[model samples]
Target chain A: MKIAIKLAYRNLLGAGLRTWLNVVVLSFTFVVIIWMKGIMVGWDYQAKTDTSNWQIGGGQYWHQQYDPFDPFTFSESHAQIPETFNENIANGDLEPSLIVAGNIYPQGRMQSIAIIGINPKQNVLLLPTQKLDTFINAIPAIIGLSTAKNLKLKKGDFTTIRWRDSKGMFDASEICIVDLFSCNVPAVEAGKIYIPLAVLQKMTGMENEATILTFRKNKMDQQKVDDWVLKTNEDLTKSIDEMIKTKTFGQSVFYGILLLLSMLAIYDTQVLSIFRRQKEIGTYIALGYTRTQVIGLFTVEGAMYSILAALVSAVYGIPFLMWQAKVGWTLPVDASEFGMAMAQTLYPVYSALLVISTVLFVVLITTVVSYWPSRKIGKMNPTEALRGKIQ
Target chain B: MENHSIIQIQNLTKIFPMGKSDFTALNNVTLAFQQGEFAGLIGPSGSGKTTLLNIIGSLDTPTKGTVEILGHSIGNLSAKQAANLRKEKLGFIFQSYNLLAVHTVYENVEFPLLLLKLNATLRKKMILEALEWVGLTDKVDSKPPQLSGGECQRVAIARAMVKKPVMVLADEPTANLDAANSHHILQTMLKLNQELKTTFLFATHDEKVINYLKRRIYLIDGKIDKDILVDH
Candidate 1:
């Protein structure tokens, strides 16, 4: 095998431009695939991080009737705060929020929204809830950039919000938008408004009651609380995982096409090598190689392209990928429009396993493709090959 | 000197398929070669001398009878055994100066020694010595395409002689060379055979090569028409 490798290396180098061209094409495939995969992984990592900071804190305990997808459940998904969490809540290690489905009228246009009440002093979530602490003639509130855009309301703008209280009686109040924050998480940004927890609880006639509890990351010793469902960070991020999985599967088709083109080039080169270098193959046999060894030599010769490509990729790919990871790949279009928790700029993440496995896969496939055409050598007559006869 | 015989052939025949009938490439031939004997199969183009050489070199098997090369029967040897025999004890030179075109002249000469798994220092020494024998020591780094016909043939000679095999087989080796290159290469082979006591066998119709042969076995239509021994 050592001798074979030596001879194959010499042969490939001797072949000159033809060999390098193949290496360049294969190397391009490696870089592109690895880079694309890295972007996807980086997006997954970024999306989950943003979601954790902007919305789900470390984890959440949802009231038994709290179905985020069903707005009707918000009316009943509340009860008096669990006394067990009072101390942590007071220490601000955990924050309790109440959700009430309501309608907002801005310039005579009514839009349904989720009116969420959060502690203005909570430090776990990356929200501008502190702005709710401002004293104003009207109720102080904050909205996401998307919601502010939809309502055509900016900071300091006043809008009337109407909702039903605990007894199903309708009530209305005016709120002054204290802030409009931007975030990557769509669930936290779209059609959502935040007001001081005490204010919303009082207005809804549900004081001292909460619909969900969000704890600081790694700060709480969690227990099974009655009438609530425990959701860990991993559980909260499952939707992102599922979405990324679908994207990966879809991208695999493009990956397959790219890989196929590169493999076909190698396969064609191997077959052509056999055709054009028949005399060399026969000379090898004449020099004392068995047909099997000649086949092995050809296969090794083809597989070396992948190794060369990897080295070549490392040459230019490392610097390019590093720069990309630092600056990130900014999507030309708005990613939030995709209706997912995706950032506008996504950093590519490359792991050792991703690079190693990709290289191995190409090498393995190239070896098989190279060996496929070389099998014809085993049935050849060496004497004819020596004469450069096509057999 | 009664040197041990390196090759023994008995009533050997080779048949090839052509259309619906079989073509007799070698018909009922018999011959033997001794170590240190510089001999040639002297014949016309279709007299089956090259076919007989191929059988003796273990590149081909006989259809009938047997050819024993260095104590191994050519008709019974497996592909691997034949290859091993060729690698360890046999050398072949083709008509077109079959030097690996992409390889440097030194690499071409070093090829057989590599197959023998010789150490690098030893392989380099033998390759240099062989190239020296062919007066190609200065052309080590030149590829075949860069070398003239005469130089390429010399590189081929260096390759065939590098391992100092028990027998060196030449199949019309001078067919592609001019008269000048032909004699130059033949003289190199004769000197190696005499100095190393290695057997030399040539299948040729070239008078230049035949003039250098100590024994000439003339072939006519795959049979030995005349076998003559000449005193030097």
Candidate 2:
């Protein structure tokens, strides 16, 4: 095996431009594949981190009647705050939030929205909840950037909000948007507004009641309470995992096409080598190499292209990838428009597993493709091959 | 088989499938070669000289005969065993100088010893000595394409002689060289044969090669017409 490697290296190096051309192509494939995969991995990391900071603080407890996908359940998903979690809430480790279905009229254009009531001093979420503490003539509210954009509402703008109390009585009130905060999580920012918990309780006639309780820590070891369901961090991030999985599947098609192009070059080179180097193959047999050993030499020769490509890629790719990881690859368009957890600039993260697996995958594929064409030597008559006759 | 013969052939026949009919290359030819004997099979094209050489080199199998080289029957040897026999005790030189084009003269010559799995130091020493024998030590770093036809053939000779095999087979070795280069190549082989006592066999109609043989076997229509021993 060592001798085969040595010979393969010498042969490839001595082939001059033909060998380097294939190596360059394969090296390009290596860099691009790793960069693209790094982006996906980076996106996954970014999405999870943003979601944890901006919306789901570690974990949450939802009322059993609450179905976030079903707005009609918002009317009944509220209950009085349980006494067990009040101590944690006082310590700022737990935050209670109330939800109610409402409609806002901005400049006479009505937009249906979810009115969420959070503690004015809550620190579990990165939302500007302190903005809800303003004392003004009208009810103070903090809206997300997307909500403000859709409704054409800005800070210091007064809008009419209409909703029903727990008794099904409809009421209307003027609300002032004191702040508009930007966030990567669309679910937290789109068509949602925040108000003080006490103000919302007083307006809805549902005092000390909340539709969900969010905690600062990730653990869910608390005993089950009636009418509340625990959602762990893993469960909360499941949707993001599914989204990334779908994106990765789509990206794999691109990865496969790239790999196929590189492999096609190698396959072409192997086939051409077998055809052009018939005398060399025959000479190997004449020099006492069995046909199987000749095939092995050719396979090793082909597989060495990947190793060379990796080294070449490292020459340029490492710097490029490192720059990308630090400065990040910015998408041409706004990423938040995709309507999921995504930042404007995604910093790529490359793991050791990614690099090693990529190299191994290319090497394994190159060896197989090389061995495929070299098998023809076994059927060749060495005497005819010595004459450089095509078989 | 003769006890003193390094190569023994008995009623050797080789046939190829030409379309739907059999084409005979060698027909019922019997011959024996003693150790250190420099012999040549003189023939025209299609006279089965190369066919016989191929069989002796274990590159081809016989149809209806046995050929024993170094006590191993060529027809019955498996692929690996034949390769091992060649690796251990045989060398081949071709008319077209089938040196690996991408390798330097040194690398091409070192190839056979590499198969024998010799250590690097010994391989280097043997390679340098073989190149010196072929007068190619000065061109060791030059690839086959960079060398002249004569230089290429000399490199092939060095490669064949690198392992110091028991027998060396040359099939039309001087067919591509000029009279000057041909005589130079034949003289080198003659000196190596006399000094090393390696059995040398040639399959050629080249008069330059024929003139250097100690024994000449003439072949016509796949049969030995004359086997004459010449006192040189």
Candidate 3:
């Protein structure tokens, strides 16, 4: 095997430009695959981190009647603050949010929105709830940038909000938009408003009541708390995992195409080598190599392309990937528009496992492709091969 | 097998499938080559000289009878065994001087020794000596394409003789060369044969090659027409 490798290296190097061309193409494959995969992995990491920071803080406990997916459930998804969380809430480790279905009239356009009432002093979420701490305001509210844009609302704008109390009595009040903050998570941004928890409880005649409670720490010992259901960080991030899995499957098609292009080059080279180097094959046999050994030599020769390509990719790809990780790759379109947790600029994350697996994948593929064509050597008549005759 | 004979052939036949019919290349031929004999299978084109050489070189097997080289029967040997036999004891030179084109003269000559798994120090020493024998010590770094036809053939000769094989098969080794290059290569082989006591076999109709042979076996229509021993 060592001798085969040595000869294969010499032969490939001596082939000059032809060998380098294949190596360059294969190297391109190596870099592109790693870079693309890195971007997806980075996107996954960033999206989950941002979601945890801006939206689902370590975990959530939702009212049993609450279903974020079902807006109708918002009317009944409310309960008095549980006594078990009172201590944690006092310590600022747990935050309760009262959610109610509401409509905002901004610039004479009515938009249905989810009015979330959070503690203004809460630091568990990245949302700018501190802006709701203002006094002398008719119901101070904070809306995400997307919500503000959709309703043509801005900071210090006055808007009328209408909602139902616990007795099913409709009431309307003029609210002041104190801030329009930016958030990467679209679910937290689109058609959502934040106001002080005391103000919403007082207005709804349900003081000390909350629809959901978010914790700062990930662990929740109680799986069920009275009428509340625990939603762990894993459960909150399950959608992103599913999204990445689907995206990865789609990306695999591109990976296959890229690998196919590179493998085709190797297969073509192997076929041409077999056709053109029949004399060399015969010479190998004449010099004491079995037909199988010659095939192995050819396979090794082909696999060496991947090794060379890896080295070549390291030369340029490492710097490029590092730069990308530092500066990030900004998408041309708005990523938040996808209606999921996404940043406009995503930094690629490359792991050691990813790089090693990619290298092994390409090398294995190249060897198989090379061996596929080199199998013709086994059928060659060495005497005719020694004459340089095509078979 | 005769103790003095390096090759023993008894009623050997080789046939190839030509379309739907079988075309016989060698027919009921019997011959033997003694150790250290510089001999040639002198014949015209299609006279089975190369066919016989191919069989003796273990590149092909006989369809009938047996051909034994250095105690191993060609027809009975497995592919690996035949390869081992060639690797350890046999060397072959081609009509087109089939030197690896991408390799330098030194690398081409060092090829067989590499197969033998010799250490680098001994391989280099033997490679240099073989190159010296072929008067190609100066062209060690020149690739086959960079060298002249005569230089390439000399490299092929060096490659064949580098391991000091028990037998060296030359199939029209001078066919691609001019008279000057042909004689130079043959003289080198003659000197190696006399000095190393290595058996040399040739398959050629070229008068230059036949003239240098101490024993000549003439073939016609796939059978030996004459076997003559000449005192040189």
Candidate 4:
């Protein structure tokens, strides 16, 4: 095997321009696959991190009747805060929030929104709840940038908001939009507004009642209560995981096409090398190489293209990948409409495993493609081959 | 089979399968070679000289009869064994000077020793010595395409002789060279044959090559037509 490698190396280098051309094309495969895969991985990592910080906060306990997808459930989702989590809530390890279906009329235009009541001083979530502390004539409130933009409302704007109490009695009140926050997580930033948990508790006449509990990662293991359902961090981020998984798989198809084209170049070169170097093949046999060894030599020769590509990729890919990691790929403003946790700029993250596995995959496939053509050498008649016969 | 011979063949017949009928490349041929003998399979095209050489070189197996080279039967050796036989004891020279075009002249000559798995120091020593024999020590870095026909053939000779094989087989080794270049190549082989005492076998109709042979075994229509001893 060592001798085969040496000879194959010499043979490939001897081919000069043809060898380098194939190497360059294949290097592109390495860089593109790794770059694209790294982006998906980065997006997955970024999405989860953003979601954790901005909204979910490691885990959640939702009211049994509450469903974020079903706003109608908001009418009955709340119950008294369970006594079991009271200590955690006091220590700021867990944050309890109340949700009420509401509509906001800004400049006589109405927008259906979720009026979420959050603690004015909570660190579990990255929301600017401190902004909810500002005292104003109307109830102080904080809305996300997307919500503010849609309603054409900004900070210091008084907006009329209306909702029902627990008894189904209708009520209306004014809200001072104290601030608008920006975040990568569209779900947290879209169609949602925040107010002081105490203020909403008083206004809704649902005192000491809550709809969901958000806790710091690993701070609370308490998962079950009579009317609450536990959701771990993984559970909250399952959609992002699935989306990235699906995108990665789709990217693999593109990778397959890229690899196939590169492998086709290698396969073509192997076939042509075998075809054109008939006399050389026969010479190898004459010099005491077994047919199997010749086949192995060709396979090694073809697979060496990937090794060369890996080296070539390192020449240019490392700098490009490092630059990309430092400065991320920015998404268009329209990407916010994805309705999931997508950042404005996504930085790719490449692991050793991703690079190594991708290289091995390409080398293995190249070897197979190379061996496919050289197998003909096994059944060749060395005498005719010596004479450069077509067969 | 002769006990004193390194290569012994008896009634060797090789038949190839044409589309509908068999083509007999070698028909009921018998021959032998003692060590250090300068010999040639003297014949024209279609005379089966190359077919006989291929069989003796263990590149092909006989349809019938036995060919024992250095105590190994060509007819019975497996592909690996045949390869070992060729790699270990036999050297072949082709008509068109089939030097590896991509390799430097020195690398071309070093190919066989590499196959032998010799140490680099020893391989380099042997390669230098072989190149010296062909007087190509100066052209070590020049690839085959960069060299002339005569230089190419000399590199091929060095490659063949580098292993110090028990026997060297030449099939029209001088066929591609001009008369002057042909003489130079044949003379190099002659010097190596005498100095190394390696048995030399040639399958050629080239008169220049035939003139240098110590023994000429003529073949025609897949049979030995004449076997003559040249008093050189």
Candidate 5:
């Protein structure tokens, strides 16, 4: 078997220029898929971690009132939180929530910012164990650096929360920024002012009500969570219901376009790779190689190219993606409405499984595409092939 | 079934289809060549001479009639069986010296021997002897493209005989060569025929090739026009 391979490989190497061109094309395609996938995955992770878009507790929950005339109510009929939710929560399988509220602050110019309410003890425990000061034990709130700069409030300085009540009544209250901290989320970078959730609820006059729940662990089945959230919001006010539906559709459409474009790039590269090897292939078949051998030979060759390309992509793609995950890639000012809705800065997520799957899928597609031309070469009449002929 | 005859053909016909019409390339041709005989197939272009030689060489199947070579009927053999038969019993030297361009002279001579599953030591010995017989022993590592026309044809002849097949088919073997180169190839082929007792079959339009044959068969329009056994 090795000897046979050695022979085939030698013949493959005879056309050095063609082989190199194939490798480059394959590698380029591989890089494109990986890079694009990294961007998409990055955007998704950033969106999920935004603390506003996706709820933090593995997932989110919402409730609706029974009628439009009724005041906003959290009713079980609107959405049912699985009974297993608390069990998973207590067992550390669920992530702790970071309650976040958004409002506009006016200085010389008006700037929008987010206020995150954190229980220092619970927040520290839920986050990845790190050396940051415990927020629960400290009285002063920890605000993100960017958020502090934007609001012109620093550590030991006082800021105020202002908002319209449910009756359209205006209200305002002064709060103090105790510390400055930053998280991986880009949205948090610009607009976060962390304080005690209890304090914010009182100041906003919501008493014991929580605005949102956030978590690091995404243990909830995405489909189940999405369905429950949608069902719960179905009976909400028309405006609120429309908001959720529009958000979901908008994200899906953006992601779909990204996937379609990546596939087209991969396909184009593979076609070019195969087209360049026509003469080399005819030579192999003329050497008494069966069609099966020819197919196997080229398929393996195509796979090698994909693997090389994927490896190159992954080496740079994974780390680059991870770095972007830690920080983020910000979109331009002229961004689409959907991009604006996602985050100012988009971070990429790294999944080993997704990378592996991408590599395998690219290889499979390349092999499949290479087969048509390879089989055409394989089935060529030996006489014509031996005559140094190709069409 | 003469003791000396290595191949015999009887009433062989080959029909080829060309663009909605059928043409008979070889029609009702019959002849025989003995072992060690240096014979030539002489005809004009498309006289069915190459077609008859291809059938005898086991490279093509006859549309009708039987071709008996080395006591096996060519018609009854499977494709694989015919390929094996060609490998073992027949050798071919084409006009263009159809040597695989990528392989060296020695590797080309050793090719048919590889198909026989011979050990490397014996294969090397036989290949060296075949190359030596053609006076190409010093050019072992050179590829076909580097060789002169005569040397290339010599390598082709060496390849055909390295397996020690019973008969060799020469399809216009000197067609691509100059006068000196053509004479050198013909003489080398004749020397191998004499020394190895291998039968030689030639399909050629060259009068020079006809002059060297002990017997000549003239073909015209897919029919055997004449067969003259010249007194050698």
Candidate 6:
């Protein structure tokens, strides 16, 4: 087996031009796949983590509907806070909570902002290596880095905020800036502020109002988490059937076309490479190798190409994604609300699990693409092969 | 054919279907060579000499009839089984020498032994002995591209014989060489045949190759036209 593999390697290496060309294309594809994967993975991690931090925990969460007309009135009837919520929090058995309210003003000049309220002490239990105390002090306010920068609100400065209450009432007040924070997920990090739950209740004039109660588990099990999400989605659809019209079929169509184009590029690379090596493949068969061996060899060759490409792509791609996570990709100022919402997006956080999964997926795609052409070797007749003939 | 016959072909036929017509590459051919015999298969371009050689080498399956090599029927062998037989009992030397360009002369010669699953020390010994027989020991480290046409052919021969196969199938082995190189290659092959008693079967249209063979079979249009034995 080793000898056969070594010969295959040498043969591929011998045809330097074809091998390098294949490697270049494969590497390019690998980089593209890895980059897209890393970005996607980064986005996904950022989304999940931010969702957990701001509102959604891995499995279940809650979102509130704020009245746009009256911004300061408290209406307990419109809010959904289970009676056991306070008991769960006091017992320290409840999932984390991410209380978010839009149109928050952290300065005298009003701007569209996000306000997140959390139990500072309990927040550390959900996130690793994070000290929620850094964002709290005697004055106590945790604001997004972008929001603080834009508002010119330093940690020791005083800031005022205004938002609509549950009863469609508007209210305004001053709070002390405590600390600044940022997340890789752009949507949550910018234009947002974090406050203690007690302080948020005082500011909003609601004694027990929360935008969402996020659950944080000790372990991250994907299947269980997804199941919980599915259950929640099912509940949401059952309760709010009219909201189903908001589902974006156009987005699915767009992504489907994009994915098809990417796959086509990969397919073309494999087809061109296999076509060029038809003669050499014939040569291997002539040398007394079985048709199975021929297919195995070519498939292995394609795999090798993919593995090499993956390595190079990984080397560069992982770091780039990390950098994006560390320093978010910024968008221009003066953008629309939607544009601003997406402008300074950071890469999803990096995970070893995600990277390994990406590589395996790319390898599988490469093997499948190469196999289509390599199967032709199984039909080759050795007599014709030995005569330097092509089928 | 006797039990000791190294190769036996009984009523072998190969018909290639071309569109609506059928082309017979090898038609009802029956032939055999004994152990240690030097045989020649002479034919024109499409006379099925290579097809017969391929069957004898266990590289291809016959369309009809049975081929037995070293007491085993070719039809009974699996693909891997046939590969093993070729690695153990049959050697091949193509017209182009087919020396893998990246490999040195020694490595090229060691190619066949590597397939035999031999240990490193035994493989080295066999390769060295084969290279020495072909007078390529001095150029063991030279790659195929670094060697002349004659040297490349010698390396191919060394690769073939390194496994000490029972028989060798040479398809126009000297066709790529000039007259002098061709003569030298034949002399080397003849010397190896006499010393080791390894059977040799040549398939060629070249008269230069036929003159060097002790026994020759003339094939025309996939049929044997003449079988001649020369005075050794």
For TM-score, candidate 5 versus 6, the one ahead is 6
Q: What is the interface RMSD of candidate 3, in Å?
A: 0.6
- Show the lowest summed lDDT stretch of 10 residues, model 2 chain A: A216-225
Chain A only: TM-score per candidate? 0.98, 0.98, 0.98, 0.97, 0.50, 0.52
The alpha-carbon lDDT assigned to residue A313 of candidate 6 equals 67
- Candidate 6 per-residue lDDT, tens place, A122-153, comes to 64233321333554334366666666777877
Q: Please name the candidate that would achieve the greatest DockQ relative to the true structure.
A: 3
Positional deviation of residue A88's Cα in model 2 after best superposition, in angstroms = 0.8
Residues A1-391 of candidate 1: C-alpha lDDT, one tens digit per residue: 8879999999999999999999999999999889999999999999999999999999999999999999999999999999999999988999999999999999878999999999999989999888989989999999998879878999989989999999999999999999999999999979889999999999999989999999999989878999988999999999999999999999988988999999999999998999998888888998899999999999999999988988998899889889998999999998878899999999999999988888899899989998999898998888888889975
Off by over 4 Å in 2: A218-222
Model 3, range A92-167, lDDT digits (tens) per residue? 9899999999898987788788999999999999999998998855999999988888888889999899999999
TM-score of chain B of each: 0.96, 0.98, 0.98, 0.98, 0.96, 0.96
Clashing pairs in 5: A42-A348, A42-A349, A56-A214, A56-A215, A120-A135, A120-A136, A121-A136
Give the fraction of true interface contacts kept by model 1: 0.75
Instruction: State the lDDT at A235 in candidate 5.
Output: 29
What TM-score, over all chains together, does every model reach?
A: 0.97, 0.99, 0.98, 0.97, 0.68, 0.71
Candidate 1 chain B: worst-modelled 10 consecutive residues by lDDT: B1-10
Question: Lowest summed lDDT over 10 consecutive residues: which window, candidate 2 chain B?
Answer: B1-10
Per-residue lDDT of B154-214 in model 6, one digit per residue for the tens? 9888888888778888989999899999999999988889888999999998888889898
Question: lDDT by residue for model 3 over B1-232, one digit each (tens)?
Answer: 4778889999999898999999888999999998899999999998999999999999999999899998899999999999999999998998888888888898999889989999999999999999999998899999988988898888888999999999999999999999999999999999999999999999999999999999999999899899999998
Interface RMSD of each: 0.8, 0.7, 0.6, 0.6, 4.6, 2.6
Candidate 4 error regions (>4 Å): none
Alpha-carbon runs more than 4 Å astray in model 5: A1-4, A30-105, A108-116, A120-159, A163-171, A177-181, A186-193, A201-370, A374-391, B2-6, B71-78, B114-122
The DockQ figures for the candidates are 0.80, 0.87, 0.92, 0.89, 0.24, 0.33
* Residue A379 displacement in candidate 4 (angstroms): 1.9
